[model samples]
Target chain A: MRIRERIIETGLFFSALSSVFITLGIVIILTYESFGFFKEVAIVEFFTGTTWMPLFAEPKFGILPLVSGTLLTTAIALVVALPLGLISAIYLSEYAPHRLREMIKPVLELLAAVPTVVYGYFALFFLTPFLQNFLPELSGFNAISPGIIMGIMIVPYVSSVSEDAMKAVPMYIREGSYAMGATKFQTAFKVVIPAAFSGIAAAFIMGISRAIGETMVVAIAAGMMPNFTFNPMEPVQTLTSYIVQVSLGDVPHGTIEYRTIFAAGMTLFLMTLFFNIIGFWLRKRIREAY
Target chain B: MTRSAIELKAEAKNLNFYYGPVHALKNINMPIERRKVTALIGPSGCGKTTFLRCFNRMHDLYPHNRYEGEIILYPDKINIISPEIDPIEIRMQISMVFQKPNPFPKSIYENVAYGLRVRGISRKGILDEAVEKSLRGAALWEEVKGRLNSLAVDLSGGQQQRLCIARALATGPRILLFDEPTSALDPTATSKIEELIIELKNEVTIIIVTHNMQQAARVSDYTAFMYLGEIIEFDKTDKIFTAPSNRLTEEYITGRFG
Candidate 1:
């Protein structure tokens, strides 16, 4: 029995250590490769230059267009997801009957399970045509359609987490609100939401992270032109999409062009890390407020 | 019984409650006097809290929780527990302070002003006036007056419960229900709450469920001894404490068995 216990303990230790090692390995590789790219392309120019003609004879490797593309899509996605997610979360947590909640939550999660590639086509073929009818200036491959689709894709992440947060709020607080003659809507918005604000904020941050990292939907729907514009109507390329474009294409190994993917990947990592830090700070502040 | 002279705020007539198949409260009949404290004393699972919750139609919040008969609010003469009556309407007139200090995660001022805000009273001056009045009514104004914008959860446990009381009072509720409001509090907090309950009865009718017989004895004008989902005895607090009554009430109050 002791031998078996010892074996299990060792197994678990290795499993935990493996994940740590893998993460450290990725960071090391990304830093190493990005360093190689930065040596050829001036760090200031890569950040400041507007044109991203990396494959041209005189390659300009400005990251702003990709960054703007990411920001615009993420901003649009947040605008769509935040309210819809919170309202749905409130409904599920406060208003839905047990049977209804049980039935609906799984269906909402199933939206997340639907492949992002499928969502990409849905954005390109179905939603784009439907949206173009109203706004004639809208391009066939534009940021708006993909951003909306990405928002729809992330609803489960936001709502599921937010609902769990709302549901975790003790029944007694809600009871206090209800006993004061507050209706379901009023109690949910005024009491429950405030109580679960930290968790809800975390959910919004999770949605933002997912939207920023999301590649396929934007890669397929938003045309991969590195356009330095915030307008959702125009074709734009996000950092993730740019990395995907390079990695999929034939770029020779160990070259400056090949190293750009690592630079983009590192930037993406930094952005997500930045948001996570903000989420951590916000949660602590709200908790202290309580 | 010279019943006609005393003003009654509400009455539970043959009230029965069920949680799914379990009969939680059975054939409860009681008078809630106007501007007086009525204490329900019982052991755990005796359904005292269950009985108090029925007054504000709290059972309606859950599924498979059914109410039979009536909790009729006097003056209005409305059956509060009836399916036709909205729970929110009954709740507007009746508020509850819970066993634990379950203050909303909001500022002290926001907590007190919540009930009024729900009722659509949003004028800043009116809110400020009402918040102060409620805080004063709950005997929490002096300590919290200076830092009303601070988070309510920052207060001690006793203060939080008092804030909840203030929150309930802001609506000017006709009745206040306290379900073991001090059970989670320390001894000093418990005594303060006891004093507050006694003082509060002059304004709104109060119904409190307490496991502590001494609390019932100290704060209540009237007392109901409940055992096994039934009220074993109902009388003046003095009479119930001093005089001979039901064998079970006698045994329960004397700390022989609960």
Candidate 2:
């Protein structure tokens, strides 16, 4: 019996260790390549310079266009997502009857389960053309269509998380609000939403991170122009899309161009880490407020 | 004074409630008097809570819960069962406090001011006066006045419960319901809440559901003994404790059976 327990404990230990090992491996690889890239190209020029002419005779390694593109897409996706997601969450958690909630919650979950690649294909083939007819200036592969589709894909995440947060609010709080003669909408908006704000904020940050890290949809629907434009109607290349573009092309191994992908990957990693930290801090502050 | 002078503030006539096919409350007929505390005492699942919840239409908040017969609020001539009566409006006249202290995640002052703010009272002086008055009414003003800006959850359990009372009082309801309000509290907090309920009887008609027979005897002017969704006996508090009319009320008061 002791030997069996020891074996089970050892298995559990190794499983936990493997996760730490994988994270350490990613950090090491990102830092090593990032260090090598910075050695060749000045860190200041890489961060501040606007142009990214990597294949030219004299490569100008400016990463701002890629960062700006990522930010623009993320902003567009959030603008499309936040209000709709919150309202749907409120409907699901507060308004929907038990039978309807049982039916609708699973359908929303299924949306999250759909492959990101399928969303990419749908955005490219169906949505983009549908939009081009109305907006004649729309490009074949613009950020607008893909960002909107990506926003739709992310809606389930925000809604589900926010619903859980709203549901976790104590029943007595809603009762107290109702006892004061507040309507259902008022109770949900003023009392429940404020109480669940921290959790909803965390959900928003997670959705933003998902938008930033998404690759397939942006790669297929948003063209690899790497332009420093903020307009969603124009083609742009995000960090994830740039990585995909570089990996698909014939770039020599251990070259500066190849290392630049790792640099971009490092930037993505840091950006998400920054968002997670802020999200965690907000959650902590709200919890402490209670 | 004659029976006519004793106004029937609220009357439930042959009221029945069902959860799906299960009968939760059956043929409950009771008359609540004005400016008095009526204590409903029973075991868990005896339907005291369900009956109390029906007063404010809180039962409608759940799905598959249905009610039969009528609950009438006198003077207003409002049959709460009527479709024209808004549930929110009914709740404004009848407020409730739960067994657990549920202060909103806000400052002590804000918790009291929430109901007033909902009513569109925006002036700082009005809110400040209302908060102070409500807190004082709940017997919480002296303890919480200095730290009114502190989060309510930071208070002790007893203080938080008083803060909840203050919050309910801020709405200025005609009736107040307590569903085992002292059940989750410590002995000292229980006494404090009991004292506050007795004090509040002059301003609002109070209905309390309690498992503690001694608490019911101490705080109420009238006592209702319930069993299996029916009121077995109801009389003056002194008479119910000393000389109950029904054998079931006697058995329950003497700890013979729940």
Measured by DockQ, the strongest candidate is: 1
Over the full model, what C-alpha lDDT does candidate 2 score relative to the true structure? 0.89
Error of 2 at A195 (Å): 2.1
lDDT of 2 at B224: 87
The residue ranges of model 1 lying beyond 4 angstroms of the native Cα positions read: A1-4, A281-290
Best by TM-score: 1
Per model, kept true contacts as a fraction are 0.90, 0.61
Model 2, residue A189: what's the lDDT?
A: 88
Q: Best by lDDT, which number?
A: 1
Q: Which ten residues in a row have the lowest lDDT in candidate 2 chain B?
A: B1-10
lDDT of 1: 0.92
